[model samples]
Target: MSAPASPQELRKLIAASSWTGPTAGVLDGYQQANLAVVPRDLAFDFLLYCNRNPKPCPVVAVTDPGDPVIRLGRTEADLRTTLPRYRVWQRGELVAEPTDITAYWRDDSVGFLLGCSHTWEGPLRTAGVPVPHAADSMAPPVYVTDRPTHPAGRLSGPLVVSMRALPGHLVARAVEVTARYPTGHGAPVHIGDPAGLGIADLSTPDFGPPPRLEPGTVPMFWACGVTPQLVLPNSGAEYVITHYAGHMFIFDHHVDETP
Candidate 1:
């Protein structure tokens, strides 16, 4: 249908398969979420993983085992259908990328909603920072770094980061603005050269497209929610589902509502 006016409207559009694209730069005042659903057996391990790597896997809302709803008691949003797209992983390999995961939903599944960097892109724009991926259709480049997060149980993977190029003067201001939203990855983990993080090339991201940079603008990296997707493959889980990179779940509440 027409463009969604609010977060709830965007979610409705996504659920109905009307808007199945990157969720960044939409519903500016509301928060966006990265979704991870794993088996009940591995739930504790994933919970511990999130606790250990709070920057990339900051836990916002988690659903009870087998529940498809977000369980914040705010709305009837169904986890199986709210996000624009989902990645279904089985036996360490991705099996499907669907607009909705109705057939994939299981009774033993648990949904964990992690904070997304897209949540703070709105605030950054409000603060006059130029974010190149400000369009809803744009997805920022993500790279797997040499820095490894503290392992918890069976989950251990190199840190994955999303990149944004900013002018020299605006980098510090961008950090200052985003640091207020800890749940949304806080601030830049590394700035300038990507090689410091073991990234061989900025153009060859492990996920999403290449970086959008102008002359005099340097690349700044932020801890990414996609880190969980990388961790889950080696976690020995039989089945896992997550939102497609950059296609986040739109939350009705604002970022301040998160703890």
Candidate 2:
């Protein structure tokens, strides 16, 4: 496989449509974010939801209503066209999957950027933890769990998680590498058995592909960025916008080094 692109290079690649798949292997050192668009009226409550559930919904940045420019992360990045794809939601249902959101822009719309697992992938790989999905060029498997998150206003729902398989012996090292990047969903929430987290099967994921669990490997689960979308119904927002699974908003902020 080719060497991964740098963050800025990945941005250019994404802009040029040279890399339209997941941001997993691109941008080896920078942070990638999950997207959430809500009306200005419900921004506070959604922000509260993020604050209350840092594990699954770490708030990386927020955009002013009607402004597509993300000031806090990737100042030059436009929310309208930066990501490879977007998902449009109306009245709690997915209405469209588009690459650009310029058509949906509204004067009352606000954007929220949340931390994603891409931030931790590099560290894990460097430490020889073997992120199978990233290594094999596949998206991490995601599932909705039975665990409910703390509610804020109308925002409430079960937590969503992404899975990665690693050798049983290196599981602790995998946790150590990821624990250093707490903003990137931190460490695994559930390991070993998917059933422990109310997840019934590994072959069927709520999003992305089923994981290939190599012999001697154990499945590890981390809070997913998709958790926000799952919670959108409870948020009561009439409309919303988010990046497609594995497609993320590239940001300018440096990844946090502390746990």
My TM-score estimates for the predictions, one after another, are 0.93, 0.90
What does candidate 1's lDDT look like per residue over 12-87, in tens digits?
8887788988776777767778899999999999999999999999888899899898856465589999999999
Writing each residue's lDDT as its tens digit, candidate 2 over 1-259 gives 3444455666666666666677776766577889998989888899998999999998878887888888763356778778888899888788899877899989998988888888988878788777777777687889999899898888888999988878778989988988888679998899988888899999999899877777887888999888888888555578988889888877665575321
C-alpha positional error of residue 161 in candidate 2 after TM-score superposition, expressed in Å: 1.2
Model 2 / residue 105 / CA error / Å: 1.2
Summed backbone clashes in each candidate are 0, 2
Candidate 1 weakest lDDT stretch, 10 residues = 68-77
Give the runs in model 1 whose Cα sits over 4 Å from its true position.
none
After superposing candidate 2 on the true structure, give the runs of residues whose Cα lies further than 4 Å from its correct spot.
1-19, 253-259
True lDDT of residue 27, candidate 2: 64
TM-score of 1: 0.93
Task: Pick the lDDT winner.
Answer: 1
